[model samples]
Target: NRRGLPEGHADVKRMMTVPIMRNDEIVAIVGVGNKAFDYEAEELEVFARYADSVWDSIQVKRVEDALWQSREIYRAVVENSTDSIVRCDVNGKFLFGNEAAIKLLGGAEAAPIGKTPEELGFCPAFRHTWDASLQYVVAQGFPASFEFDMEIAGRTQTLDMRFAPEYSPTGRVVSVLGVARDITERKIAERELARREEQYRVLTETMKDVVWVLDIESSKFRYVSPSVYALRGYTSEEVVALPVDHAMTPEDRAALKALTLDRVAEFESGSLAADHFYVDQFPQPCKDGSVVWTEVVSNYYINPDNQRLELRGVTRDITERRQAEVALRQARDTLEQRVEERTRDLTRVNAELAAAMQVKDEFLSVMSHELRTPLNAILIMSQVMLEGVRGSLNERQLRAMQTITESGQHLLAMINDILDITSVQAGTVVLDRALHEVDALCAPLIDRLRAEAATRSQSIDYVCPSEPLYLWADGRRFGQIVRHLLENAMKFTPDGGQISLFVQPDLDRRVLSVRIEDNGIGIAHDAIERIFQPFTQADSALSRQFGGSGIGLTLVRHLVELHGGTITAESAGMPGSGSRFTVQLPWQAPPVGSPHGAILAAGAVHGPHVVLIADDNPSAQRVMGDALRAAGYEVLAALDGIEAVATARLRPPDLILMDMQMPRCDGATAIRRLRQLPACAATPIVAMSSVVVPNDRALCLDAGADDYLAKPISADTVVDVVARHLAPGRSLIDAASGADARPS
Candidate 1:
């Protein structure tokens, strides 16, 4: 080696340099000087080996320093952590416990080192669950987590616990490191959130308004309430899957899409508040192929959890409200026009209507007399002939006479029905109330109509309780009600059809129900209400097949109502389906401890009573006289009111039947004159007439008649009236005072 030192350098005889390498990089240098000889190969090799050993030692020292620094950092973290951290051996003996762990047990004095949880006096419940989790980690060589309860200080704490197996260098699980977090407040918050969610779900599920959530970006429903199905005929799941505009019409869909985009843009631009509502109305199509109007109220909001912009809304059906608005607008538009037109026509129309009504009232009054007078003669003669008064009749002759009598009676009934409806409409009809036995009132009607039912080969089934049930009503009108209802049933029923009458009296409700059912024809459901209107039938074709003025049921209903009752008609609208008419009438039982007295007593007069017949028509006088004479009574006939007074003065008859209309003088004037006489002052006088209006009946009784009878009288009615009056203890009837002299 040549000496190449600078002027102040140290002198060296021999020198060698060795490179120290670690991981293929130079880490340090080793140099030797003044070795007393030149460096040999053996000595250099020895120095190289020695340099490698020294490098190994430096690496070990570096590793030790790094590990100690890492352990100090771990200790700091474990001690400062809020979570309780501890290490336990495989036998569950505590190896170490951090400050938090010691605090969790109680304090520094209660540190868990060198003690199992049992020895440390931990709650058994927490210890069991924690120890099981630790043992599982040791056996499975994995981490385990659980939730447990531990009593710390004076309060029980809910803690989330985790156990992890600590492995040695050979991968053996030596001990378990446990960490417990106090999550009591967090658990309470989660429970409260779950409870609030349940309440929201319940409210949305039950409410009729549809609640929904829509994703702003996708324009699709994210959640929909169960009520969406009721609102739009789409299930919640189906609605959630469908686009927001699926229920809208094509035009509405396009409009709504543009509107929604504008709304979102407004929100983004900060022009609209997040809590602001967007309310709109549009028509939506239903699954049933119908369109309905809907109102949607929505608010744009960003979901806090997902940071998603969403629309929360409620929708309601507004079809009915919209329709009402349209109707109101139309009515408002036409109101002024109609008012002007009506104002112009009111005076003239009023005059015309007044004249028409006056003429109509006069026509009905005159027709009642003109029609019933001849009807009376026809009915009287036909009835007399049928009873074999003149001679015996063959079967065909009897039926022919019967047919004539029936036709005349039917005409008379039509006239009476027209007058009745007129009186009912005018609200002038008055009822003559009397205590009547229900059985007695109903039996005669059934017997009278049974022959007609027999002609059609049909039978009427009559049902009534055997007990004596009474009703406080007009007996004659009640009889008329039953007859009309039964006739209606027979008319509609086919030949061989069945009719049933059920009479039920309810004492508790104080009502009587009369149900008339027939197996003939049924009415249509739509026409059930129409049939109650005057001159309206269930079907127009029925009028052709069945001869009716269509006013029978109308009159029946009016009469029923006048008697303080209600009537209902039921039918199925099919032939052979039959019909049912039920009538409910107010019923009142008689006084409990009172005796009922008859209006007139028969058989009180010992001798044969004279009944003077006074009338203008010879046929009427002859028919009445003949019927009276056959009833074992002395009969006097007068063709006019003049002879009637004269005959009564000479004879002083026990009873007098006076006709209202007569030639020369009317029966009213004659009765006044006859009452002036002492012998005839107390005599019972009945006024008979063809005009049966309420005023007409009042007029006759006001003129001192005991009772008033309409024309077309039956022989039984005439005889019964005479017998009742001729009996003793009969008082004069005062018509002006509203006294009823007629028997029930």
Candidate 2:
């Protein structure tokens, strides 16, 4: 009955119900007494105004609810963040701090709302710097960040801090918001990483091995060691420009890549064990287009920056080692063939076994000569290359040649040593007996030893008499004995330890007592007696740690005995306790039949250092004499080789300048004859000739000249040649640097 009708009209049919009008109040009510619509236009307009008012209130409520939710979300984000966040006014009062901020400031007591940085007791360090930074940001209205250290809760912390100004609507910075991160652990880690990088850099640059790092993704070398120059004849920078396969043959490269990729795949798929490395050997081309055998070892690791796997490894040029193995194999095959042939004639072989041993000894001597010949050439050529004889060389090439020369010299020394020991053992060392001045021989050796000692921070205290101690023995072999003892002392001595060599003469006994003592690692009591035995050492482990031929002492003992002498060793067997080696040799004074002893005296030189010039060519002799005279050297001219030797013995010059070819006797013959005299034994003799070839120099050296100089010689060349040979120390240490570690 009341449908579409005003409320309260159900009971009374004529009743009119209108909502109470409070200007803009209710337009309608659910139970209001119904008012019949007798509509006036103004009345409807008033109703519309009331409806709009109701809609306005509801919209206001919705907006307020939405803003409440947004504030809550922002509050949650600030609280949950790991970063320490704080909001402060321009005066540096803490307006607000998040959870992380409170925790970082030692939980709430040290830092709280309205408290300034000065009030934060948990982290007093960096307070001044932090305050300054905040003030700057507030004044400048800019963002700033810095790293500083802080003492926090008994631990030192490195903080990464940032400050930003929060502006008001008027564009003024009212407060500064700061964020601090404790990056203490990170900074320590970074420092450790830097230390490791520097260590590796030093190792690679100094090591003889060639280490490399490669970018697998780019298929390029990223890092190459400086030592690559020695192995491949290429500079590190040059190697970086080369592709990984640039030096490999196509087939080898393909095979290598296939194996490498298979390993990589296995690693990625977890089929390969962790930390497994790959090993390979292949022939690689050098800068000179020669092939070298290389042994490579490598492993893959991910690059932290790009997250890509890379290759890092060391390579060794094993060409020499491989060549030696081949030679040994060839020698074995030859021996097996000879053995089979001898087996067919065993009866004949038994009859000539002693003869066969003699042949073997001769063969070894010939082999030694053959080896030295090429080695001399190699040493000369390497010197030429190092000096840029053909053209100027870069640093890499120079260093490479230096290493080559050093290695060649060391090999030559080893060959000489082995051959000598073999010859002595086989009773084939024929002594070319002559008068040798111990003092003169020791001069050059001590100089060499001092150079060696300087590298190890060791010192040699050598004391000998001013007078020459003449020994009638093989001069070369005697020199070898002293050198071996000195080298042995140096090898065993620790850094900063002292090695003492004293040569004392026993006039009554007609003998010399040479003592070489070192404060070093000593020998065991049981091993002292056996030390002179060939191939025997105090401990085998020492032989491995400190490399030796195991024949050094054996050679020393034999050489000493060969000169009618005896050698002995004494040690306490305690670590850091020293050992002493004593050698006694028969000391024979020089021949007294000649009156040349006065001229041979050390202080007898009254003029410029005397030099003997011997040349059969009349014009040549004059030119040589004039050159020597112009250089402030007293010249003793000899018309021929025969006269040269006689004159050198009579007038013991400081130097002998000899021509290779002369009448009646050659320079070689003259040198040999002069060397036999005690007065001329250690004189510096230089050969001047048109031939500067290595063979000619070797021949002259074999004949006992100190050095060789080609003819067309200038006065300056003569002076320098004389000066060097007179001193005879051209830093041989640099030539045999690596070998100095082992006793010769």
Candidate 3:
């Protein structure tokens, strides 16, 4: 049996088996016996053909089984899917629908197989769209998608529907398979996100603080709010185009860069929390070249777009807050110093106390300048009008103009009193002493107050020496002392009261004594010294009864002390007993043959002197020009220092009245520049300014000005200054502006 030879014919000699197949399945087996010889190729070939048929049938059955299995899997997947899946015929009739589809159509009642979307109670508005999509898919043999809103279970549902053409064996589109996703919840979320974004936009746009986002990698702003213009003086687009540290100074920029690097290191090291915020304060430079302190609150976040860490910050100006903190600290320091020096000598304590009170002097200086700048125009213009410079005025107009001038002067006095008290207490007042006549000072002051007394039905009587009384004193302070005493008399005295002034000269002691008496509201004996204190009236009730700042006598006493004189106040402690103030001054005459021995008259004017008035205020320029023109001088005005320099170079002036504070080029700078010019070198330059302080005149004079004039200058002062400065052929006699021109 191991060899090719038959082991044994066996019991039956030869046998063969054949497999019978039906539909590729083995139905039966047949056996044949007594075969003659071994099968030849021809016989075997026929048998092989039958066997090949059976193999073919088996292959076909395998393919059919696999296709059926694939169909079953596809059906299972379609049924389990959450999306609504359905098939429609070319005419839009439903061929099959899954459970999701039935649920989408409201319990299968509204939608059923073999029914079109319209026939199955679909939205009428969507019916045409559905039919059109089906037709398009059928015609183009391509897939299509659309979205529509529908009602399901008594609620609105938004569906995103896709249609694909189902092809036949011949590649012809038979029906459309639709898959719809109910995106109702997704749409609601999207709408809510949009609304919240709009609300955020509104908040950031309208707020005062600037909100911005920075791209860390680019080191530039990614988004900047419109409010950036207010905080840093840059537009939103402009800021976005700039570097993040553009508004920072060089030192600040370096610090900020270092801080950012540290923050980044902290973030990468996991030492900083993801939602941590930072607060920073620094000085930021503005577009206008000014610097302001700002507070920045920021947080780090990863931008979803680039998946990179970025900074979102809110910036607000804190310059005013910083100033307030500084002021508070200064106040604390001042309080400590006051307590420490409380037991020192009176003079030393006073000087130190004055130094401590200099904190508000800067603010007072600014306020004084601003108030006096406009007031200069008002007073000067009113004076010019009253003098009939422009034209003649009727009686009514003259009276009105006089009232305006008086009111303006009253306001000026009050302002000066406030400033003078500050200056005197601070011990910063410097006297510009000059020769003055007692008659000239007392007579005009008496005349000035006579009208006010008449209005109150009061009579003011004054006695002066028949001969001119001469003394060495500051004319302005001398007048102020007398004016305050006169005003005090008028303030305390009742209507129809009598006020008297007695000027007595004692040549034996080289002293002059002046006495003023009022017949109403006498001071108490105990408060005689107290009345001379700053901001103290004789009686507390008198403050409300008579409207006065109560610093008049205080200023008067300080001024008299500054003049090397003594003043005394006497009262009888009884009403109607009257009050008397006596001031005594030791006189010193000018040296014989000295020019100061005689009052310098405004010498003769040879020619129409060309005077330049340089001021920034339009009204001030106009008034000064008119006043100079009325005084027989050719006047030219420049709005600012730059123009003044240019004008002076073009047409040289005999005298230049330059304002200290002006736009572009200031008076100090202009004067210094003008002095370099050959034509202006010898020209008389008088510096004028509204800011009245001890050092202001020095500053003006140091700027190459021959003299300085304080603001609210009367026409007489201007004329006298011009005449004295421009007297024939530049024979300089007394470079002083005027004896009466005093800066408060």
Tell me, by TM-score, which candidate is best: 1
For candidate 2, write residues 1-744 as lDDT tens digits: 447748753654333234534468864542222456555657556665665676667668989999999999988988998888999898888898899988876787664788776776535557777777888898788999989787766888888989999988999888888888889999999999999999989999999889999988788899999998988899999989988888587669888888878878877887666578888889988899888899999888888998988989989988998999999999999999999888869967775886887788788778888988999999999989887897888989888998999899778877878888887887778666544567877878999989989989999998998766654456788789889999899999989889999999875554688999999999899999888898888899998988787788998998876655789899888998999999987553433443234323311222245678887777776555544443334467887789997887667877788898877898898999999999889878888777767698788888898888877877557766775654422111111121111110
Per residue, candidate 1 scores C-alpha lDDT tens digits across 656-676 of 899988889998999999999
Candidate number that wins on TM-score, 1 or 2: 1
The 10-residue segment of model 3 with minimum total lDDT is 735-744
TM-score of each: 0.44, 0.40, 0.42
Better of 2 and 3 by lDDT: 3
Stretches of candidate 3 off by over 4 Å are: 1-36, 109-111, 169-171, 304-306, 323-744
Which pairs clash inside model 3? none
Tens-place lDDT per residue, model 3, 1-744, is: 365547665555675656767689986555455667765557655665676676778879999999999999999999999999988888888788899998876566664877777777777877887787778788888888888888776788889999988888998888788999999999999999999999999999999999989988999898998998888789999988888778688778888899999998887788778778899999998899989899999988889988998989899989999999999999989987886776466678778766767657877888899999998999999999999998999999999999999888888889989999989987788766544678888898898799879998999999987866665557888999999998899988999999999998765544579999989889999999899988888778889988788899999999987765689999887989999999977553322454533333322212235689999988887666655543435567898889999999988988899999999999999998899889899889998889979999898898899999999887668767887876643211222222332111
- Deviation (Å) of 75 in candidate 2: 2.9
Instruction: Assess the local accuracy of residue 653 in candidate 1 as a C-alpha lDDT between 0 and 100.
Output: 80
Regions more than 4 Å wrong, model 1: 1-13, 19-28, 34-37, 40-50, 168-172, 304-308, 327-744
Q: For model 2, state the Cα shift of residue 190 in Å.
A: 3.0
